[model samples]
Every structure is written in structure tokens, then in C-alpha cells.
Target chain A: MVLEVRDINTSYGDVQILRDLSLKVEAGEVLCMLGRNGAGKTTALKAIMGLVRPRSGSISLDGVELTAMPAHKVPKQGIAYVPQGRRLFSELSVAENIEIGLMARGKGRDTRDRVLNLFPVLNERMKQRSGTLSGGEQQMLAMARALCLEPKVLLLDEPTEGLMPSMIAAIRDSVTELRAQGVAIILVEQRVDAVLPVADRVAFIENGRTRDTVDVETLHGDLSLVHKYVGVGH
Target chain B: MDFGPYLFLAVLEGTVTAAVLALTALGLSLVFGVMRIVNVAHGEFFMLGAVLAWWFSSMVSGSPAIGFLVAIVMAPLVVGAIAVLCERTVLKRINYDPEATIVATIGILYIIQQLALTFYGADARPVQAPVNFRVVFPWFGYSGYKLVVIAASAVLLLATWFVLTRTRFGLIMRATQFDSETAQAFAIPVDRVYAVVFAIGAMLAATAAVLIVPIQQAHYLMGGDPLLLSFIVVIIGGLGSIFGTVVAAIIIGISDGVISVFFTPTLAKILATLLVALVLVLRPQGLFGKTPR
Candidate 1:
């Protein structure tokens, strides 16, 4: 296993969020975590990335223990998180925002060219403050910033939330391309159809615990299982 | 009454005051910019700088020029090191909590003040200016050192602006200031950044103090006026704004210079306080400060 999390329990100040959550992913695999709102999907990723402390568990990346590590150090250990809400430094210019990631990891200035290649629009608006960009543009900047870390594991929280349909398709294509490059990804997404093609397996989470893990092909043939877990109207 | 010459003198004096105040208040603004903490002890750092300058200048033999240069270089470094130590030992312990850090800094202020009084004695001491030349104006002669002070402060302020806008260090500081949480996620050690910022802020205040010590007597209690003026400047300039701090310092510094020359110094202070109240009530975000999102 490239990344393994076992028996992880986490809480936010007495409000328990995840209980005995266990998951695994191999290199080049895209693990899509599907759940309704408040189903602990974000919390699971947060715990794995060391943004929030897990009470009891083991999080290992390529056999190295990552539990209890500081969030700042997590990226250096090969994990990059594109947090919810994009969280781009609004006042900073686009180039500066991407530089934050590279500076943190001590990567050379040339690495920016590679990340900017992934999102060409960002390259054009390198001098513009990120807050002025449209939602789609800002999202692209966020992804580019994370990719600057050159992480082995990418944790994306709601990358498609509130995006237009066209933007969602663009993000899906980026995710598929990244997965093919052998970067392990744990994507927290609500849009099932947008994620299905890219996801090798989907973990259905309900009320802070994983209900089951199903292969994408098997679940695609029987849409009712997804409906049962995620609700009707798909 | 021939008031024209007096008016020119007042403006010159105000410009001098404004120059010094800009350096001091810029330090305060930068601290607030990165740490979001109101350093009540910032004035004490200024006091320490002046006090150290006096000590360093007095110790050296021969011309005052060598002593002044030595003090100028030594004071800010010593003060900056002291401040970094304080950040590590005290401020860091409080987790940089807004209210808690304020209280912590206030405590530091008293500790430093009392220590100065204990060791430096109660008498105010003046350091001799390295250059004792005068530039004769139309009505009167002005100390060339005062003019040098004004020019030096301007150059230093410009250098500060360059560092903040054009350098990689400034880039990291701005990124940390914009959103520390996001910066941290990218692997910036925010705690260390905070420590460095705290030191730089203190060092700026120290630089201002070292520059001004030749003109004014260094007293343990002299910090009160600079402290009050700096707060006024930071508040009026909008917290954490470098450009705004400089602009506001000039306005207040010149006004105070002119007002004190014509009227009582008490009234000048009153006007400054009134301006603070007005800015807070009308444009709380300050002239250049962005509205909180």
C-alpha cells in the first residue's frame, strides 16, 4: 500500500467526527470518497493529511508513520491538500500564491513552469491578485499551488463544489491526468457522474464511518446501490 | 509679528518628527500586519534601542563619529536579538493570542522600563552628534545633523518599501500575512515566520530610536511619547499598512510640530487624539486598509 490509514478516530473539540475509519490506496489509484453533506468525508481527509489530529490511528505513507505530524510538515512528507473553499491567498498575486508552495518545499523557481503548464490560464494571469479571478480560475490556481509541492499523495476536498458544469468537466480531466501519472489521489466529491470515470473504487461514507467500498464498474452497473447510499434523484 | 520664518521652521521640525515617527510606526504596522498582535511593548523596544545607543557611544574613545556609527549598527542588532528571545520565550507560549499577547507585551513593557531605570539610572543622558555643523536658513540656522536625520530616515524608509515590495523575504511575509493557515498547508513554518517578524518589527523601532537619540535625551520614560504617537499613527494609517503608516505619520508629525510651536503641546496631543476618534468612527478600516473580508 502506498498510503494506509487504519482505525482512525477524530473529533473537533468533543464533537466526534470520524470513528474507526480505515482506508487504503495504491500509487496511481484514484479513491473517490462519496457521501452526503456532513457525512465526515472532509474530516476523513483532514485526519489523513494531519490538518486535524486523530485520537487513535495509524497513518502511514509508504511505510513511514505520519500520525501526529504537524500539518505544515505533511506536505514535505509527500502529501498536498487542496482545502475546501479553494483558500487561495486572495490579496496575493497568482504567481506569489504558487510560489508559497514551492518556497515551502524549497523547490527551484523552474518548477513553477511545470505547474503553470497544467493550468495555462493561471500563467496568463500570473500578475493578477487571486481574489479578482473568477471561481473557475481561482480553483485552477488552488490546484496549481498544490501541485507545486510535487506530492506523492493529493487530497482534494470538494474541488468541484459550486463550479459550473463545464468547469467540473475540466477538473475531472485534470484529476484523470494526474492519476495516470501515478500520483495517488483521495478525492472528496459530491458529483457522482463527474467522479465515476476517474475513480477506480468509491468508498461510501455515512455518519462518520465507512459503510462499504465498491468497485466503480460494479457500482456503475447497479446504480441503485449508489442511490441507496447517496440518496435518490441521480 | 514675522510669522513666515517661524512657519518654515515649524514645517521643517514637523518633517523631522514625521521622518522618525514613520520609522517607529512602520515597525508597529508591520508587527500588526504579520502577527495580528498589538505589541504594547513596542515602545519599550524603542527605549531599549536609545538606551543601548547611549551606552555604546559612551564606551568608545576618540571622536563621537566612530561611537555614533558603532551604536547605530549595534543597537538594532542587540534589540532585535532581545525581541526574538522574547518572542520565543513569552509570546510563543501564549500561542500569539490577540488579547493574551497584548497583556504579555504590556508586562514586557513594564519589565523593560523598570530594568532600564534600575541600571541606566533616572537621569536623562544625551549622546553628542557625530557632526556638529549647521545649515543657515533665511531666518535661522538648523543643525546639519537634523537634516541628516531627515535624509537618513527617508532613505531607510525607501529601502524598507523596496524590501517589502520587491524581495523574496517580502513575498514570504506577505503570503504569511494574507492567510497563515493556507501558507502553513504549503509547508511554511508559520511559527518561525512569526518569530522573525517579531524581531524585524523590534529592530525597526530600534533603528528609529538609534537615529533620534542624538537629538533627544534618552530617558527610561521617553518611550511614552513615541509609544503614544506610534499608536496614533498606526490607528490613523490603518493597522498593518506600510504606506498608510508613512502618510499618516507625516500628517500627524507635521501637524504636531506646527501646533506645538504655535499653541501648547497639550493641545497638539488633543488634536491627534481627536483625529484618531474621528477615523475610528468614520473610516475604521483606515485610509488604505482593506475592509476585513
Candidate 2:
């Protein structure tokens, strides 16, 4: 396994948001997490990134304990997270935004060229401030910013949530390309229909617990899992 | 009183006062821009600079002009180092609450002021201007030292502008101020940056203190006016408004200079405070502050 999470429980001050949430990802595999609104999907991702601390249980990437580290330290340990809302440094230029990501991984020119090649739209608007970019462009820029880190495991929170159909397809293709590069991915998506083609495995979570988790082909065959667990129209 | 020469003198006073206020406010603005804390102890740091310049000049046994420069350059560095220690050891922890941080810094201000009084007494120390320096442009009846102040302030401001716009470290500072967590996510080491910014702010304040010592006698209480004026400049100018302070300083300088000429210095002080208050009411962001995004 490339990443292992076991019985992780977390709370925000008083109220518990995550309860014994456990998920695993093998090398070169796509793991899609499906859930309704407020279903602890983003919380789970944040817990892995060390943005929120887990009160109990263990999370390890490449067998190194990651649950106790700070949010800034996560990327340095080979895990890059494209947080919910695509938190790009809006005031900075497109190039500067990308360069800031490199502060985490300063390997060389290959990182810059690789990120630009993946999100070619950003190459033209390198000097423009990131706040002016269209929503699709911002998402591309956000992902590209994370790509500069050369992360072994990419954690994406709702990558296509607010994007158009064309942008959605573009993101879908990018994930497939990344999958082929032996990079493990954990995608938290609201649209369950799209992930059947891209993900090798699927886990359905509701009310802070995982109920139905299955292989992608198996999940697609079982429409009742979509209706009962995913809460898609019955 | 000859009208032409007096008018020229007034213009020169406005220029000199603006330079003084603007340079001092630069460091205050820098600290606020990066750390979002109003360092009330800044004026005392300026006094330290003036004292250092005098000490250094007396040590050299040559031109007092050389001593002033030493004070401007070295005093800030010393203040900056002290600030680094002060920030890391003290201010970093209390930053979670804005009101608490301001109050804590006020306590620091008292401590610093008392230390000055203990070591250097309450009596005013007289330091002479350079031997070559005197009221020049006697044709216009204006002081040459005031013009020099204007020139020095302009050069410093320009240098600061260039560094902020054209450097990566500057970008990091901006990011840290605007959104510290994001800055750290980019691996900027936000703690180290904060310490450095405090140091830089101290340095700027010290330089202003040293430069003004020749015109006004240095006393333990000397920090209060600049401290209060700087606060007014920053507040009326808006927090973190670097360019706004420069423009407002000139406006305030001229207004105060004119008021003092017409009436008295006490009346002039009230008018200066009123000017800042009126600006705050009409345009809360001051002359140069951008609309918050």
C-alpha cells in the first residue's frame, strides 16, 4: 500500500466531524470517495493533509506517520492536496503561484516544464494575476500548482464541482494521464456518474461512516448502491 | 518679516516635516504590512538611534555628519536585532488576539521608555549639526539642514519602493501579511519572516530618530511626538497603506507647519489631529490605500 489510514477520529472543538474513518490507496490506483453534502469526505481529506488533527488512529504515507504533522509539512513529505475551493494565491501572478508551490519541492526545471505542459493554458497567462483567471483556468492552475510538488499521492477535493462540461472532461483526462504515471490519487467527487470510468475503486460514505465500498466495475453494476448509499434519486 | 523669504521658509518647513514624518512612518507601515501589529514602542527605538549616532560621532572625534549617518545605518540594525528577539520571544504568542497584542506592546513601550530614563536621565542631550551645516539659502531665509532631510527621506522611500516591487523576499512578506497560512504552505517559513520584518521596522524608526536629533534636542520624552504623529499618519493613512502615509505625511506636515506659523505650536498639534480625524471620516482608507479586496 502506498497510503494507509486506520480508525481516524477527529473533532472541531466540541463536535465530532469524523468517526473512525479509514481508507487505503495502493500505488498506481485511483480511489474515489463518494458522499452527500456534509458527509465527512472533505474532513477525511483534511485529516490526511494535517489541516485538522485526528484524535485517534494512524495515517502513514510510505510507512511514515503523517497524522501529527502540520498542514505545511504534508507536501514536503510527498503528498500534495488541492484543497476544497481550489485555494490558489489569488493576488500573485500565475507564474508566482506556481513558483510558490516549488518552495515545497525544489528539484529543478523539469518540475516547471512538467506543470506547464500539463496545464498549457497557464503558460500563455503566466504574468497575469491568478484572481482574473476563469473558474476552469483557476482549477487547472490549482492542480498545476500542486503538480509542481511532484507528489507521489495527489489528494483532490471536488476538482470538477464548479466547472463546465468541457473543463470537466479536461480534468477527467488529466487524472487518467496522471494515473498512468504510477501516481496514486484519492479523488473526492460529488458527481458519482463520472468516476466509474476513471477510478479503479469506489467508497461511498454517509453520516461520517463508510457503508458501501467496492471495485469500480462492481460499483457501476450495482445501481442500488448508488440509490441507497449515494442518495441519488430513488 | 520679509514675505518672500518667509513664504520660502514655510515651503522648506513643509518639505522637511513631510520627509521626517514619511520616513518614520515607512517602518511603522512595514511592521503593520507584515505583522498586522502596531508597535507602540517604535518611538523609543527612534530615540535609541539618535543616542547611538551621538555616541558614534563622539567616538569618531571627527565630523558630526559622519556620526549622524552611523546612527541612521547602525541604530536601525541594532534595533532590528532587538526587535527580532522581542517578536520571537513575546509578540508571536499574543498575535491571536488583536486587542491583546496592542495592549501588550503598550506595556513594552513603558518598559523601553523607563529604561531610557534610568540610563540617560530626563535632561535633554544637545548634539550639534555638522560644522558645515547651517541655515543656508539665506537669500530665502530657509535652513539647509531641512532641505537635506527632504532629500534623504525621498531617497529612502524610493529605495524601499524598488525593493518591495522587485524582490522575491518582498513578495513573501506581502503574502505573509495578507495570508500567513498560505505563505507557509508555499514554504516561506512564516516565523522567520515575521522576526525579520520586526527588525526592519525597528531599523527604520531608529534612522528617523537619529536624523531629527540635530534639529531638536534629544530627550527621554522625544519619542512621544513622532510616536503619536506616526500613529496618526498610519491610522489616517489606513493600516498597511505604505504609499498613503507618504502623501498624508506631506499634507499633515504642511498643514501643521502653517498652523504653527499663524498661531502657536499647541494649537498646531490639535489641528494636525483634527486633520487626521477628518480624513478618517471622509476617506477611511486614506489618500493612497486601495479598496480592500
Best by TM-score: 1
DockQ of each: 0.76, 0.43
What TM-score would candidate 2 get against the native?
A: 0.90
Model 1's DockQ score: 0.76
RMSD of each: 1.7, 2.9
Candidate 2 wrongly placed segments (more than 4 Å) = A205-213, A223-230, B1-4, B55-60
Q: Count the backbone clashes (under 3 Å) in each candidate.
A: 0, 1
What stretches of model 1 exceed 4 Å from their correct place?
Answer: none
Over the stretch A69-147, how does candidate 2's per-residue lDDT look in tens digits? 7666777888888878887778778987887787677756788998899889899999999989999999999899888
- Tens-digit lDDT track for model 2 on B1-293? 68777766676676677788888888888887778777888887887777666666666666677766666677778777877777877888875256777887788788878887897788787666653446646574455676677787889888888777678787777777777765655556777888888887888788777777778777777888888888888877776777788877887777677666667778878988887788788987776775666
The superposed Cα distance between candidate 1 and the true structure at residue A194, in angstroms, equals 2.8
In candidate 1, what are the lDDT values of residues A1-234, reduced to their tens digit? Answer: 499988889998989999888889888999999989898998888787677889998999988898988877888987888989999989988988888878767887677888888899887898999999999999999999999888789999999888998888888889989988899999998778867889998998888888898889987668877787788865
Candidate 1 lDDT (Cα, 0 to 1): 0.90
